[model samples]
Target chain A: MKPDAPVLQTSGLSIGYAGTALYEHLELKLFPGTLTCLLGLNGSGKSTLLRTLCRLQPALGGQIELLGKPLQRYSPQALAQTVGVVLTKKHYAGDLTAYDLVALGRHPHTGFFGSLRSSDRALIEQALEAVGMASASSHRLARLSDGERQKIMIAKAIAQQCPIIMLDEPTAFLDVISRIETLMLLRKLAREHQRAILLSTHDVEHAIRTVDTFWMLRRGCRPVCGTPEDLILGGAMASLFEKNGFTFDPLSEHRAIAEHARPVGIEGDPAIAVWVNNALIRTGRKPSPIAPSYPCINCMGKNRFTVGMPNGACKNVSSVSELLTLLHEAESMPAQPILPRYA
Target chain B: MRAGLYPILVVLMLLLFAACLVYGSVFIPFDAVIKILAGKAVERTAWQSIVLQSRLPQAATAVLAGSALAVSGLLLQTFFRNPLAGPSILGISDGANLGVAAVILLAGNPGQYFLGGYWAVIPAAFAGAGGVMALIIYFSAKVRNSVMLLIIGIMIGYLASSAISVLNYYATADRVHSYVMWGMGNFSSISLERLPLFAVCTVVGLAFSVMLIKPLNALLLGETYAANLGVNVRSVRMQILLCTGFLAAVTTAFCGPVSFIGLAVPHVARLLLGSSNHRQLLPVTLLAGACVALLCNLLMVVPGAGTVLPLNAVTPWVGAPIIIYVIASKKHIHYFNEA
Candidate 1:
């Protein structure tokens, strides 16, 4: 975390839809420069938590504060300047271009007439650049693909120049590559801009690999908050799955069932990614679409493919003696692709 | 004027105004018509009175009513965020109708209804308009969604119409006849004596509209986004409801429920501006509205005639096609940011 004030906090808060209570007695704080991934199963109050913090769906009990100011204490204009929200719902209703949409972030600072001042335009351009959307700056909101649209939305929030950016399931409609790219962009924002990027995403592996901290919510349980390593190492990841059938493999440090887990190996560098992918398929592993993002080598064929192992040794392998070492490295880095080997 | 909107509107309005000045229910030569306007000697007393008194007021009334209705329609469309929403849906004008109904039917007996004197028409209209405005404001406060409010407004209009029907059913034949004439809708109903009051009310409503131009732009972004931008959403909605009600009520009181312009002109204006910026939208709405109403009024002259189309019939023909065009075109203009 960047030594800054907390960007989002809930003090013993209860949240709900208009008249119905969904969750209560919740307290949390997210500091600047920390990418917090909020997770929960459906109906576990994930969206409810976000809405309360955003102060859109008002809290029925306790208070939510941003930057130490009670959420309601800040005027709408003041709050807009301090906090930018990207809801998963709306893209844009108006026939505005990408520049127009991003420039809307400056709406808080711009006069009621809402003109584009030079500084405002420059900041808008900068935000687009930050989101890697500079090339698409002139695109209309309706004309872009889902991932591009999400980036544009974040670009708009950045244009507001708020310290805290809260997004609710921003990757919901994006394709896998777009989702990972968006997550990477968010991490970049947190690391480089020192802005808090708190987002709720259904992409669990992506979140685990990219975000600094986790806010995990399960039905009938208090939200579990901790660093990703703590949550994974402390056997918290096992509880996230079914206890009877699904189990965490300590040797591999991955979430899987012991009965179905299998080993398949190939030789040579750069073939590891494809070897593991084909092996997982051979073993009837579901092969979640996101498992192959990292490049890997196969010892037998000396070919490369992007395939990070779920629970296996993967690194440089001169001989089968180094198989365990590669698995440990793969688990530790999570981003590393598991290489094919024989020990 | 970029699309030649302002110029087209000005030239069209000027030519129509001139036509109204020259041709009328009574035939007058072009030379005499030009001479009368130039303050030269004219031969005919009746022609002078018809041209100077009847046609001039009528033309002025068409311009005023048309502009007011167009701007009001534009405001309501933006406020409700619905293509179908319009000023008449609120029944505010119908509320004025009921008020005028009461004055015409139940106020006194037959010919003596005018016994309230020439002063009665303007005050009665203002009161009726004020009454409807109050009702719409109250309903607006109760409803949260603009779409819901629009539906409720339609229901209110039906209720007002029913009430007017009941009043007509019970009134004497003479009162019924006069009320029916009133409902036909007229451009020359505002006499020279009553011009100042009508002018004052319309100007005040239009001025209020100008003040609202800023908030109206924010509102086009949708409610939550607008609130995020520090717009007092509830208060803005209330103010809009009041403005719509007031404008509709005033125009209705004087023009006898002038329809179509309130609903279609805004869509036309939006097409003209090609953007949602209210700064441009509001003026375009005003000019287009004035042109439409004045042209429709000019249609009444029919080259050498005074028999105008019933305002409601002509308005639907003019208003419906524009509305259809907007909807058909809407499918083509993609909403880019709908994530």
Candidate 2:
């Protein structure tokens, strides 16, 4: 295979269960030294596509080429040597240590007895260190956090020495920090190792920042593939959630929920005003810059605030909660400032 | 630690084997037993027969049966990904029991069946166990879920056991008496003459298990991951079913559903080694099963009690507490929640 050729390429591929195609005639490519994120709504065939690509499930139609060879042609061992995958489903690895779990990635390379030779041991250690889990090599999976366990799983994939790696929802269960860390790790692995890495994830914001390519899957639509910026510029990300009655917002990297509310002007330090604006939006109110009127919140900074009422009365408050409460009372009282004044 | 534990387990198994041989219902002198085992002429001919024929075969049967059943249990537990899974859980042993019940109860005279010697039950037991295994393999392929396959196996076992109870109800009193005695399980049934056949079948089944260690370890990551690692998941599943079936069937055939050793020894092995990698787990389980079985055999003799307990009666005493501890211990919960 040419060095610049896609490590995993597909043309007119269809994937689904038992003759019914959830996706049909799809074109996809994963190039070396690039991280691709497969993004989709629930039941949009993300998992089915990954499973079919990994040969865990049979494709309904089309052809997949792994390293310039037809997927159906490679033996299971050869295929394993080329493609490494980390599934979303947790397995019975709790009793195994990080080293033991990662060593499992060397199955295709190991001999008949599956014993680790010195070279295999070195690779296992390198894989562990690559994932930054070298210190935790002796820790059993059960003792590790979910993110740590996921890192070990990636280390196992790395130890496989495969040119292409695919993960299904690798960050689905991790906290925000772990999600970012895992995505950063994937990008690092793709770049430093010059391997093609594809991961399916719901962490779109992080993926947008870290991944080089995006495959947007929508039901009843031809799968769209491009750079994350290209998809956003083309407005494909906005409509990706259209079928589910959601408008995807690229800026937020989530479904945009339109909130209708009365606008309240916030007069405060710009830094403090941003948080106050966020608090207002969360409470079904919009923050407006024009603040020279009643029904305005004065953010005096350091968590102290004053709410101006329509009745020309001002309520001093020490907290955002108190400010919002005074605003609530003024709004509920039909243009009358009914909030109790403190002496 | 596991490296040190392996030799200790081997030593323990050997000591238990010797103890089983030395302290049966009639205590045999250690020197006389050693001499007999060496094929030397002992002072009394009866001592020679007692050591070579009675105690030796019984001890050997315990070792073989223990290893076979324990490995079978390990395979089932790992295959199902359920720590609670064992030989008896799938009803393969009960199928063997049903087969034995059919041979003893349906045949006109139990004495005539015994005329072929203690080997008569082997064929029927194999058939019964093999039949259930075939059904399980078929369902395992059809049902995508392991727990569902496990439930179906249990239901099949219930059917076999219910059939046995019905057979017992219709049989004559003396025939039922003979069937019940067989149900109690005894290692002494495999005489010195028949030990070779039992040894061959058990060893072959265990060899198949040894070949499965790599795939078994791969499967610890579940079927999809194992497949990704180049394991032929379907073929491995079939191999596991066949190996566990052959081992469980052969041991149940000869030893009459020897309990607890199959279900509990793997857990003991895992706890001692602190790893489920199956590289060490399989062999350690084999040796530990032998040790436990031989120990149970020695426990049956009860030293100076002058009476031998039924094999099944002594097995639960050793097996049940280990299983209970495994279930109750928070440390091992990761092994259980897999299913």
Candidate 3:
């Protein structure tokens, strides 16, 4: 649990699939007792990174060291006892109960011919309870929903008693509530169990709130590693999206498509044009007949309300940055604002 | 440790052993038969030899062959992770049949065929069985999944059967009849002379299976997990194939290829034990199979007066239903562990 003790390390690593290189010349270290999240676009190498670290998939180059020794040096059994993986689910051929599947975690602990001891059973039950699946222990896997199935898979990994656990896209198939709950459980595991937990997720908000390290894979090369705050402050958030219509929003940490990006001019008289422009931007359609009765608009700079294009064609205003600055100033006054849905 | 299973097996074996003694063309007195078995002088000479030699060994062969085949079946089913896998599934029995056919028909001299006389069939059948095992082991290693390996085995069996058909086509009429009779399967085909080899192979095969008990228990979690638990998947696989093939070849060589017991007895054993852990399942399967075979041998006896029926005919009646029940039952299906 020491900060310097490495749970998993890759040196000069290159990983690929079916002979095509995904990444090369990569060096990374995952520390114990911390939850790390990998954030990336759809085709980014998050899964490849996790797989290569665990040695599940063959690393195309370099070596993976676990506890200061080469990964392949450990026997499969010994390595399995140290690291537990919750892989994406596929076909599991049986009517095994949740408890029965979880009990399989004890396989690495028991003797080749040994019976399940009391300790093994206790661990299985505890893991079941860890995921809030204690009462549903007897339910067959065939009867469980997607959320419940994810919990069972996680519970099984917990029972394995490994010091390091890694998951790939664990929240991909979950609903919003289940996604939050899964991240919370993982956070608890990182804190209480003192196990290094690494997970890949596309849910940006959950990753920001729950994880200790955000491995941002924005540039599609060697991932940039830092705290969530560092990632946002370093302008890494701005390049997260490459699509033609969208741009990353710093304040909300979201993607948005810009419209009516006209700049306001003729400020003066206590920035009256800025105030009216801010009001128009709020409705996103146009200002609801800018209240002529309001004194805020009394000191108008333009010739009796210089009419501009409603569609934000910028028939008058030059740049959208000016309009955004005005809105930022007005929004700071009193009312707590609501961001747009797409933004 | 169930009170019911062991007693049932014991009683069935005993009743069948008793019935075999009293059964023959002529009515032999029960008291006289018992006295003869105990070394009391019998008044009749021909009947004495028939009871002591023909009937006793036939009954013994039935038990031995049945137990070996059933245990082999259980091991293969578990190894392949398929309910349908058995000795025949891998073409081990077909290879034995081909060996027997080559000796009886295709070979120039009938004496050289079983060569060294009746002693030759064991080595001949073993070599044939060994060939088939090599194919199965090759397939198991190359194929990643259990079901795919199973299909590979089926294809191998088809090739063996086809090879057998060609041999049958070219064989002379008299040799063809012998081959056909061997195909029908009969325990009485094992004479008193070959009993020692049969017993030896069965014991050796059974002993080899004991080494697998630990790996078998680990396998219930599936192969990758089993390997993760330090079980060497390839070595264990090789050992299973050799043991299962040897047991089947010896039985098929000596007793005309007994059927169904291997495929069915394991299910009954699993149902009785209620756990797939091989430590419990293996012994129960061997014992259950022996008892079933012994009982069938007893049934073939017409109770104090009749000729013995072929064991193959009686085994199917006992075996086929259990197999059907295992396959057709949807609720209790379990996939055996494979690495």
Candidate 4:
């Protein structure tokens, strides 16, 4: 019960089903006040591991201790009181109001009739407030969008008042904005509420940017757990999906860039040069400082770019779209002097 | 809204109950019926008999059968997470039918030895329904998918029905005729002497359902989420099966395979309450079921037309439209999705 003690710990754990193990001899820890993301390729046992840790599924050969008690030793009610889980299953929330759904999180805490007491009601409202969904308390779930429903679900978990919280791909069906919002919410809960939060998601970029720790899983390999930077620098992220011919380059932009490009030299403000480099790569041209003989695009420091032609003609464009059009026109007519597409 | 609606439902149920007593084929006056019910003497003793022995018991049967069937339907629908699931849809009533068929057609008149034929048929119906319920529960454990479990229940019902068909095909013509008559369903089948047993059985089944309000509400979130909420999913499923099984069996034993009430009434309650929280939904469904059943009973006697329509015939008129509305407006209902 010490403040600094890890709320959840696993040692020599093996997880799987039907007598086969997906992972074996694994060691993991989740401390209070930190967020951990379980990242893995599909069918790489991310769900199996999470389900096992939550005691939804049994572990193959290891012990999971939550709050200093072995997971198997806790009954379902006791486990519910200690660990709150938000599964990825699409439950029927259509008939429940936002308040009703959040109140369901008090299942283990309520009386047999499930009548909420004064304290329980306050907790439900506070939980809804925490997720910024207090205003939607009386609205039926069918009226809300998927993102709103997801927030309500998180509110349900928060109302559970457990020391540890776990979610399974909570952002899977959410839009980008909601995804970031949910991640930020989880991070905030971990830091401010001092709860140990864990989630499994395929959103690798967001996971790296938001989570405090990563549990990277790959088939036939022991899970590698560490801070995001440590894992990235150690090349564990790269090896996760290496077998599928997918490479994870932390330094490169997440969007795919062309392999073959016409080299161009650029010199300008560093801020403008960065976007100019993006524009050149997107237009199938490589921007480099030393390629002085190639057609050079000069960055003019305020969303302006000057394309210098080999024939000593120059054209300036104000926006990236105009720059792309000018680059395309210039590339299509290399034998002619570059026309000023955008004055 | 619930506060206003519940009182309205109670009043409607009372009106229907009064209407059932006053407007039967005999056409007893409302005042005389009230006087007879209040234990006052009436001029025509036959009028007293008709009011007390006949319409009173019939109305009470309708109330019990309606609530029992409706609550059974609600439990199955919530357990399966399918709006279409109900006692008849899952073949549980057919199991009862097959049981009664075996007892009446095959048992060679156990009524003669048991003082009344129902003494054997009631238990037989429970056994047959319980057998099918056990089969459905077994398959539910084996199959994780609700739709699949539902299909298996239907298949099991078909098997029981085929067995009943064979029994019908070879039985004596008189026995076959009686079995067919029972199959049409009648609320007047239970006499005043037998009403207490029926009431007790239905009440027990309903009590079980009441005890399940919390778990039933949890189940609306689907089994995994319910389990995460510390609900013992396996035990709850078993309890639901037992409760629905007992309710379906008891009603089917006395009323024949009463149609549509079990399948359609929960949706009526849901639509009326505009929510599926079982604490509210279960009681509202019970009251709505009784109201519909009483209304159907009143509609059965065409006000001295001298022809009493069968209960099953009257139920579809009330139950089918609601079901059709539910299907046509499936998106608006937002009950549950197959996925």
Candidate 5:
């Protein structure tokens, strides 16, 4: 095996339960010092693929190689030392403190009795510190919040000292802040530890910012894999959620749009214009500076704005809240017949 | 908290054991019992005989059976990841009951047909329990879902109970009466002659449980996490099944299906320790189980006017309240948080 070979590789792989396949004849590779994000709609086989890669579930057909060897050839214990995993399900550790839970990662390295050596303890402490969970090391898992629990689980994987780590929807249950923190932590681990980290997430926007590579799985299609920029520019993400009126906007990093969004023109200072555009977009109105025959907004100051109707009737507002409320009411009103002069 | 509680549990267990030894129908004074235990000749010969032959074995049986049943409950609860799981819940004890029913009802005079002695019933119970355990293990392999496997166990238990009920309906009056007494459960059934075998089996089961501390702790994180940690989930599960089956079977065969100890004691240990790390929980559970069982044995003879309560009848009074506490405060209880 070449030293520069990807940390994980799969060729012509098929994944699913029983004889049925959710995906087939796939090729993928994850390299060291890179974070890869797998994005897909629910039930698109992201988890199944991860399970197959880790050898937790049998692949329907194909080859999975870890560290440049066939996955099946490594013993379960050997595979554990090669690849660590954080599953989507919540772990129940009974009354174990955060420290005790992380120490369990030493199972593959510890003695038969699972006694931790001094070196093992130091690694566990270091892993906890890496995830910023050192303060909660003695805290019971039950007492910690979902974000804290996730960090602790990551710390456990780190303590395992594997070359590759896989997580299934690690950010699924966390708040926005935690979601960003977790993705950022994964990116840091990949770069600093020189480990290959692969995670599946629904938080595609955040993932796009932190991941080195993106693997997109869409229903009934071959998985598309590339750098974040390649997938975005190549329109792979747009096709991912294309059925639900969702489009991936590269400039804004927004992956989905509402089906009934209306276009609104805005002219203002660039700084205030960005905020106004964000406000309009959030309210299901597409803000653009160049659209004619549509209602337009002109931001004259930080807290003042004018709404110009297609009929040339203008309403002035002093606050964003009032502006939004006026826009909402106007949009809800039925359109009046256009006069000959306005037309 | 667990470290402090260990010495307390040891003292409590010893006190309960002494209580069981001294307070029986023929009450010997505590000092006299101690003297008798030390192999000294007492003034009354009958007191020595009662203390030596009956109370000594009864107390020993309670300790062994209690610890064995508690350990079995802990293993099953962890394996199923269900707090309500126990030896009885999995139908192993019911299987033993069916075995005894078969021997006493289908065969003529349980003592006359096979081995011509009381010893025949034990092997029959072991076979029944072992057979049902094998069936459950087979189903477990086929059914990947733990909840589904648990439901299968409950259904298997119901089938065994139904079979036993049919046997009860057709058996002779005297045989039915004896069977009813056995079903009520008794710690005194194992005479001094049979205590050695009982001790051996219980000890072996408990020892095996100790060896599984690491895997049990791993499983506390769930099967996926355990497997990720290099635990062979299939083999560990099978080992747990075997240990639980053997312990529950041996205790049921000798003691006529002692109740609640197997179901309730592990929770009591967790409550006491405030943690479920099996290294501490298992030993504390063993001690707490012995204490609870010994206390129940003492309660059985509380009336003292030549009337004794059935072990099963007395067990629920102690076990039910603890279970209720667990349920009532389940949200506040850290141990039940995952469940």
Candidate 6:
């Protein structure tokens, strides 16, 4: 195989179960040293497509080439040496330490008994370090948190030493920090190790930030694949969630609900105004540049804010909490302004 | 820790084997038993005959039967991914029981059927068990869900049990009494003449189980992951069914449905080793099963009494508490490392 050849490629591929096609005639390629994210809603055939590529499920139609060889021609063991997978299903490791679990990834390379040699052990250790799970190597999987377990699973895949790695919803059950960390780790693994890494995730914001390529899957529509920028600029992201009452916002690279609250004007520093707008939107009040009749928040400076009410009563606040409190308190007052004697 | 535990378990098994030989309905001195085993002249001919004919075969049967059943149980549990799954859960034992029931109740003069010295019940049991296994294997292909396969197995067990009840209703009084005795189970039933056949079958089944350790370990992660790891999931599942079926069937044939050891010994091994890697777990389970069975056999031979207790009656006493403890302290037991 040429060094620059794609590690995984599918042409005119169809995927589904038992002759029922969820996707048809798909053309895709995963190159080495690149991270590709498959973005889709639930039941959008992302997992089905991944399963087909990994050969866990047979392709309903078309051809898949692994390292320029026909995928079907490779035996299961031979395929295993080339492609490693981290499934979404939680495993019953059963009192196995993180090290033991990761060592199992060397099974294809190890002999029939799966006895790990010194080199295999070194790979296991390196894999653990790659996922930042080296410290927890001795700990039983039961003792680890979900995120830690997920990282350990990824380490297992890394220890397999495959050029292509595929994961299904790897960050689904993780917290925000762990999710970002897992994605960042995959991105690094792809670039540094020059492995073709493909992961399916609902986290579009992170995918947009980290992935070199994107495969957008939508129900009843052919999957569209391109660079993240092309997809966003081509307005494909916006249409991706159009049927689900969600609009993809290019600026945030996140999907937003179509229904939004009425806007309230705010005059503030650009940085603070962004946060202020976020706070207002979270409270069901949209931030606008102008809403003269409604209460407008005027940012005096950092950490200082003044609410200018329609009735001419100006209230001083020091924090976002105080600002929200003043806003809520002002909501119950009469609409007519009570003119102050000094004013 | 597990490395240390293995030697301790092996020593314990040896000690129990010695106890099974020395302590029986007829108490033979330890030295005399050793002499008898060594093919030396013993003090008395009866003692020699008792040691060689009864206790020796009984001990050997206990070891093989116990190991076979335990390994069978382990295979089923891993295949189903349910800790509670056992050798009998898949209806193989019930199928054996149904076969025995047909012979003892439907066949006239059960004594005459056994008078030829070759037990027809053994072949009958093997056939019935094999039949159920074939049916299960057929269904296994049709039903991809493990839980559903488990339910189907349980329903098949129920069907076999109902058939056994019908046979019991028509059996003669004496035949029913003998059948009930057989159902209680006994390691002494395999005489010196039949021990060789029992040993060969059990050893082959166990060897097959040893070969399955890799795929069995993969199965711990569930079928999909196992497949991704290059395991031929369908072939492995079939192998497990075949091995478990043959082991459970042969053991049930020779020693009437030896209970508790099959269902409980794997848990004991898991607790002992604090791991479930089948490479270590399988050997430990086999040795532990032998130890537990020999212990039960020793307990059955009540001191100062000529009569021995039923094997099943004594088994639950040792087995039930372990199972109860396992169930009660499930959260504390790291049977599976789950997040």
Per-prediction share of native contacts kept: 0.48, 0.68, 0.19, 0.49, 0.50, 0.69
How many backbone overlaps does candidate 2 show? 0
Q: State the lDDT of candidate 3 residue by residue for B1-339, as single tens digits.
A: 456776777677777767766765567889889888998888997777878887778778877888899889988987877788888767899888777777777762443334343665667788788888888788788887888887887787788788888988998877787677667777776667767777888888888887787776556556654554456777888888888998898888887778888988888887786556576678888888887877777666555555666667788898889888877874564433210
Q: Tell me the tens digit of each residue's lDDT in model 6 across B135-251.
A: 999999999887798889889999998998888898888778767877899898887887888999999999999999888887777888788788898999899999999999999
- Residue pair clashes in candidate 5: none
- lDDT tens digits by residue: candidate 6, A68-135: 99999999888888999998897778578888889888877877777778999999999999999899
Candidate 5 local Cα displacement, residue B15, angstroms: 2.7
List, residue by residue over A15-99, the lDDT tens digit for candidate 1: 7777777767888888888899887767778888876777666889998888777888988889888878887766234555677
- The local distance difference test score of each candidate is 0.72, 0.87, 0.73, 0.86, 0.87, 0.85
Q: Rank the candidates by TM-score, best first.
A: 5, 6, 4, 2, 1, 3
Q: Which stretches of candidate 2 lie over 4 Å from their true place?
A: A242-255, A259-274, A285-343, B115-119, B337-339
User: What class would a CAPRI assessor give candidate 1's docking?
Assistant: acceptable
Worst 10 residues of 5 chain A by lDDT: A246-255
Number of the predicted model whose TM-score against the real structure is largest: 5
TM-score of each: 0.81, 0.91, 0.76, 0.92, 0.94, 0.93
DockQ of 1: 0.38
How would the candidate models be sorted by DockQ, starting from the highest?
Answer: 6, 2, 4, 5, 1, 3
Give one digit per residue, the lDDT tens place, for model 4 in A185-263: 9999999999999999999878888999999998888889999899888988778857764555464443233445676
DockQ of each two-chain model: 0.38, 0.58, 0.17, 0.57, 0.54, 0.66
lDDT value, residue B322 of candidate 6: 90
Q: Runs in model 1 with CA error above 4 Å? A: A1-3, A17-21, A91-94, A132-140, A241-343, B1-15, B30-35, B38-41, B45-47, B108-146, B333-339
lDDT of 4 at A294: 57
Q: What is the interface RMSD of each candidate, in Å?
A: 3.1, 1.9, 4.8, 1.9, 1.7, 1.5
